[model samples]
Target: MTFGGLPTRWEPPGASRGVALVAPGRSYPPTAPLLDFTRVALLQHGFTVQQIWWDSLTRGEEEPEAWVRRHVAAAHAREDADRVLVVGKSLGTLAAPYAAERGLDAIWLTPLLTDPSVAEAVGANAGRQLLVGGLADALWDASVARELEEGGCQVLAVPDADHGMGTRGAVRTAEIHLEVARAVEAFLAGAAAGAGA
Candidate 1:
């Protein structure tokens, strides 16, 4: 499906618990390992997934936050789901404020903690939020993560993992992936229960 001329990949389960809108990083497409695993996890959890694709080169003159908000909001409106969840990575974390504004649950992978706006937005979310970041990532700030956790957001900080959440060894990297995936599942389970409540 396409929303506002932006390409999207939609997968709707037979009976959806809700909608999961995936926003990828500037260089990361939905097909990347982190996002692909997230898509599968959401599908397994009975969400209708909508993954948006975009080229940063073509973003034109709009501000990063404004562009992200416009496209994300457009896609959210197009989905028209009663319940919504947002999963964003890296640059896509720019949409944090929008998701927070709508009180939607969200999972942020490798969020841009270096950006004050992004960190602030993530901290402001009233709904359930899961934030995963690598300790080795230059953009990941431990202090900020601690503060966000204190504010009620769930956080998973992987040791020896870089910006791509990859460790020095393949085996360890795979283990990290599994760990992140399990965290996602647990977080989604909690979100599902909260929604049912």
Candidate 2:
């Protein structure tokens, strides 16, 4: 499948409640553990998942914000759903501004909190937003995450986890993954309930 004219991997469930757009990082593709598991979680939550494949060789040269705006806008134009959720990670977190501007629900994995604009966007979003990041990630700022949480965003700050949310041992890494997955599921459930209300 193709989304916003970019190659994509589409997974549509039998009865979808909405659409979930999965945007990957600069080096991390959708097939990565974090993103792939996110796709599975969204599917389990009855969302049609569209995992966009970025052409880093070409589109990566464009400004981060601009690239996200163009592709996400195209996705919105093509998708016909009452609800839309954006699941982004790292470079993909640039979509924060666009998602905020459009009032879309989002789950940001390892978001680039180092970018003031991205942090501001997350804080400004009135719609449901889930931010998951690790304390050990250079781009993850604990203070910023706390501020966003105070502003009503759901946050999962993992201690000792890296940019990939991986901890020291294999067992710990798996535990972190489970924790993240549970957070995503709970967040989506709340969003769904809020929408129905």
Model 2 over residues 75-120: C-alpha lDDT tens digits? Answer: 7778988888999999889999999998989999999999999999
TM-score per candidate, chains pooled: 0.93, 0.92
Please state the error at residue 104 of candidate 1 in Å: 1.0
TM-score of 1: 0.93
User: Which pairs clash in model 2?
Assistant: none
Per-model lDDT: 0.88, 0.88
Candidate 2: regions farther than 4 A off: 2-12
- Number of colliding residue pairs in each model: 0, 0
